[model samples]
Structures are given as C-alpha cells and as structure tokens.
Target: MSKRLLARVAALTTGAALAAGAVVAVASPALAAPLGTVNLSQTSGLVTDSPMFASAVTSAPCPTGFGEESALRIGPAETGPFTNLTPSLGGGGYDKAPVTANPNRSFQLALGSAPANGRWWVVVECFSLLEGRHPDRFVTEIVVAGNQWRVPVVEATTTSLAVSPASPVEAGTPVTLTATVAPSGAAGTVEFLRGTNSLGTAAVSGGTATLTTSTIPAGSWSLTARFTPADPGSFGASTSAAASLVVNGPAGGVSKVETITADVDPGAFTLDVAQPPAVELLGGQVGGTATGALKQATITDLRGTNAGWDVTGQLTDFTGAGNIPAGNLTWTPSAAKASGSGAVSAGTPANLGDTRTLCSSAAGSSAGTFTCDAGLSLSIPDSVPPGAYTATLTLTLV
Candidate 1:
C-alpha cells in the first residue's frame, strides 16, 4: 500500500473514535439542575390536624428530552428513608409520575395517619430521567416545624351572652336572648339553654344568635349559649358564661265587675179562707207562690282598701192589672263570701220600690271580693186576679 493512503486511513479511524466518544458523553447522566424554589403553604406553624400544601415554580423547563418526577416526603429531622406521606402520587413510591417539560408544579399532601408528636421536616425531591432504576437528582429539605407541629392542643374560646329586658320583667312578657361568639369569623350555629333544658338552636349571623320567647315561668333562670363549630378540627367548641334572669309575678288590683240577672218562676199555691165550716180551698193562698234568684255582682278588690266598700240593690213593683202593692214583695240579700282577700257582710231586707245595702267590708279587712245572692218573697191577697207579676231589680257598687 502507498504511505499517503495509510495516513488517510488512520485519520478516518481517529475521526470515528472521536465521534463515538462524543455520543457516549451525551448519553451519560449528570447532576440535574434545581427544580425551583419551593414555597410551603405554611412553614413554621404547621399542625398535624390539617393538610399541608407546597408549590414550586421553575423559570427554565425540565432538561430537554428527559422526563422528570416530583415527590414530597416527611419524617423526623435525623431519619433516613423518610416516610412517604403522599405515596398515591407515584403508586406507592416516594416519586411522583413522570412528566416532560414541567415548568410549574404543586402538591397537596394529606397524611393518611398522623405522625408521632415531634419536630418534623418536609423534603421535596425532583428526579430527572432515571439511570437504570436510580434518580439522578438531589432533594430540597425544609424545616416545616422546628418544634411547633404536633397534635393540636386546642383552647376554648370565650363567649358572652345577654338578655333583653335584662331582669325583673313582668310575667307573661316576652324577652330576647342573644349570644356573641369570639373570633367573629367562626361559622356555625348556637344553641340556647335554660338551665339544662334546650330552648332552641339558631343559626349564627355575624357571629351572633338570638331567641325570643314569652313562655318562661316567673322565677329566676340560668341561661347559657353553646357554639357548635362547622369544622371541629379547625376550631374548638365554646360555651358562654351563665346569665341570670328574673321574672316577677303579676300585679294586684280590682277586676272589672260582672253582673248577672235571673227571672223568677212562681208555681200554683193553695189558698185558705175563714168562713162557715172553715172551708179549705186549693190554689187560693195569698202568698208562697213566687220563686226567684238574686241578681249577682262580683268584684275583685285585692288592694286592701283603707276605707270600706258597700254593695246595694233596689227593687221595683209589678205593673200588671189589679196592681199588687210594692210592699208585698220583699228582697233579702245573703252574706257575701270573699275568695283570697277581704270579708263581706249580709245585706238588709227591703220591700219593692226601696233600696237595700247588700254587703259591706271594713277598712284593713281581708274582704276584697263581694257577690250578691238576693232572694224575693211575694204576698197575694184574696180576690186577686190570677195573673203573672214581675219586678226589676238593680244592683250598684260604690
């Protein structure tokens, strides 16, 4: 072979060798660029009761022509092979599903079980294309809870309750009760309780609940307001300080007088006459024929009056044919009886066309109530026509 031809062959071999070396260098794995700056939803004040969130934004895309996987792990500060709290991302692996050219990524880590009560850290690992079975990237570590993350020890919130018409309300009067909850942004309802009995439940608006009722008994009452949080894990239940309410009994006074009038029914009466052989006749007696009930009056004078009060009644004679004398009918009033207060006296008897005092109560006496029970008696004379007789009776109070 010629010497020039041999030199040309050697040059071609060197060129081929250099090209193979370049290809090998391109395929080999190298340290990956940073995924980006990781930002936690909450860094220092995280608690085990709520979910954790994280996000990362990259200005530059993932290494071209290579797939990347993102993952999040939480464990004790000095532990290796930390627990994969978000295994659902990568099918039970600490790595998330692979993606190409991810510029921005976010993760929501809801730990299936609460971690041990201690300090913990969150590690975000972004892996480049795998070489065989191993990731070719480093992890970014963040101290989420230096010492603050643990099972939450919730503290109760203060509450205040108030009642309208504060106290000493007259019986049968309606009252309004209101409760104000602290952390006014809390969302839920409030239940009002009287002693141990539940009055009702009211939805909270602007952190306040109110109830109005008129059925509360006349006595001292203890009222309380209980708050039920919509999310118990986020906030604790709270109860208001006990409130006092007093209701008073009704006032004392005289009631309006009521009047009742009744008619009389007189049956046949036997008559007796003095004559030869002393004849005894049927339906001939002058009197013992008329029957009647008294006109009634009821008065309630609960206020012990300094001066006495009197009840009087007046009667008018009948005006039918063969007029019977006004004096023939007599009216008698029975003793008045009082309930709960004051005494009463019997009334005087009077003929028709005259007024008679029915009852009287003395000063400072326990006789505040009065009722009338007047009776009437009729007298018929011989030779009187057989007819019905009626009279009007009027009762007055002073």
Candidate 2:
C-alpha cells in the first residue's frame, strides 16, 4: 500500500477460509448496513412484534459461531434500566454476562413483548466466537405506551366479484353479476360495469350482492363488477377480475310473418253480353254462306257460392225470302279472360240447333268472372234463296 492510499480510509477484503478452520476478514471498513424494518404480515401465531424480519444486511463478518441477540432498556436513551431479551449461556461459559452466539451461529432475534409503558431501546449486540458481546453493533429506539402499537390500524374485510351465465350471451339476454365479500356477513352494494359504463347497482345482502340485466347491446365487452361497503371502515372496496362477454346479434336472414284476410259479402250473380257484327249476305242468289261472330258474353258471380256455370246459345230460323234453319249456323266457342280457381272449357264446334253448350266453368269452382266468345259460320243452303235474313239468338247462363 502507498502513503497516498494510507491517509485514505476504509479497506475491505473478501473472507477466505484459513487452514486452521478460522476465516480471514478485511482489515477495517467504514459505514454499517441498516437492519430490516419492522415487518407485519397477517396476524401471527407468536404474541410479539419480532422474529419476522432480519436486520438490513450488515458488512460485519458472520463467520462460524457468530450471532446477534436483542434486549430492551426502559428509558429514552442508552443509559436506561435494562432487561435481557435472550437467556444467558450455561455451564462453564456462565461467566459471560450476556451471550448472542448459538452453536450454529444463526443471529436471528425477536422482541417478545413491550412489558411496560415507557420509551424503550431495542439493542442488538454481535457476539464473537469467544462468547463476547459487542453492544455497539446495532441499536434502535421506540416509545411504548400500553404495550400496544401507537396509531394502530385495523384490517378491512376484502371482497371478490363474479359474473354469471358465462360469456357469449345473445343480445337482449339476461346476465347476472355477483359480488361476494370475504369473511362473510359484510354489508355493501355492488356496481356492475362494461368498460367504463355502469350497468346498474344492487344492494348487498348476506355478504353478497347481485345484478341482472337483459338490455345489453351486441358487441365484445370487458365486463367487471365492483363492490362498495356500506361501512367503509369495516370492509374494503375491491374490483373483480375482468370477465369476457361477447354479445351476439340476431341470426342472419331471420324473417317474420303476418296473416292477411278478406271478407266476402253476398252479392248478385249476373251476366253481360256485347252485340256482334251483322252478317252480310254474299252470293244471295246462289244462297252462299255468311260468316259472323257471336257476341261476347260475360258472367260474374259476386256470391262466393263456388258453384259452376255454363252458357248456351240457340238461333231461330230467318223469316226472309226463305228461312234458314238454326242448324245452318255452326259455332266455335272459346273461353277467354277467365279468372278463378276453377277451370273453364270451350264448347266444341256445333250448330246452334237447340241450345248448344258454348262454354262451361269447372264444377265446384267459380267465384269470379269469365268471358265466352265464338265464331259463327252460317251456311246458306242451296235450296233456300236468300234475299235478306234476320234471326234472334238467345243466350242463357245457369
């Protein structure tokens, strides 16, 4: 070591095992590491305020057989009346006033109790392998009143929240949220949330609270439940873990139906007819044939009787130079513009000799209107001389 480094100060060397079972230590060092602060977990089995934590680590060498012990003095300073916190060594080593080292050298210590009300000092002394105690090693002070910690705080009851009906609920479906308080019998209210929006609140009962809702819209939601105790001092407020909620929309292509109805009133069933063009008598001298069309006839059945109907036509002989028989006119009947559930058929070509069928509606079908038309072929017989002819055709519907 140089003289410049000599004026310096603290020197530390790593401890190494010596051949004689003893360990070599640093020459000297400045600065001491603090001991652990008072640590408190849940209430403990031991009745004292100690043993849970070790002092902040110290640089002092803790070789084999080295240990630390604690004691309390009744005064505001180091000179106060003292009491041994750890028992003394036994047998031939009884000559020592106080001992800290255990055979295993575990320096763990505890303050069993604050027996009296007064300012107290917690003194920890390190021990050498020779049963020697160094009181100057570690020291801390405390002011005790009634053997109780000053400004004591009470632990509050905790609560947990949960949701029901699982996730992936359909929109407009009911979802239930529940909150349960720990240790039971806690009085509080629970508020439900989806993201930052509030769903509603429910009053707590029997250590639990619930909320059910059915109006949530369709979407993904980060849902959670929160609890607020009615007596804040007795119960702690807590939020539940986020619950995943996926609300689905209505299924695709859904359809709704409505019924339609109509009423039918009793009405008259009637027929209508349009006049046909007159037939021109061509080749009058030889009594040639005349072509004409029968009038269009329509039948309307406003009465929903579902009964069928048909129309027939008959023609009288002409009373001109010589009368033509009704059989001279052959007709071809056709049904047109017919509307109904029933079927309509055209009558076959036949002479209007005696009320030949023109057209007919299917049986048990009708309830609508239909029109019947026909082409008339009047064949003038060669035996009859035709100067001028006139005839009457009668149509009847039944």
Q: Compare the candidates by lDDT and give the number of the best one.
A: 2
Candidate 1: tens digits of C-alpha lDDT, residues 55-165: 333222322222244455555644544545444123222332222122121221344344445444454444434222222222334433332453333445556899999
Off-target runs (Cα >4 Å) in candidate 1 are 1-156, 252-398
- Using Cα atoms with residue i matched to residue i, what is each candidate's TM-score against the true structure? 0.30, 0.34
Q: Model 1 TM-score?
A: 0.30
lDDT of 2 by residue, 1-398 (tens): 10000000011100000011111122222212222122222222221444322222222322122243332222333564444443433333211233232211111223334345544444444443332443233444444455342312324665566666887888889988787766576677888888999999988788787888998888888877787777564457778878888888788835456999988688768777653323222222233434434556777876777778877766676555567787866665677646656566777556767778888886687677788766555555778652445666766788
Clashing pairs in 2: 35-55, 35-56, 36-55, 36-56
Q: After best superposition, candidate 1 residue 316: deviation in angstroms?
A: 99
Candidate 1 residue pairs in clash (backbone atoms < 3 Å): 270-285, 271-284, 271-285, 286-380, 341-368, 342-366, 342-367, 342-368, 343-366, 343-367
RMSD of each: 49.4, 53.6
Q: Which candidate leads in TM-score?
A: 2
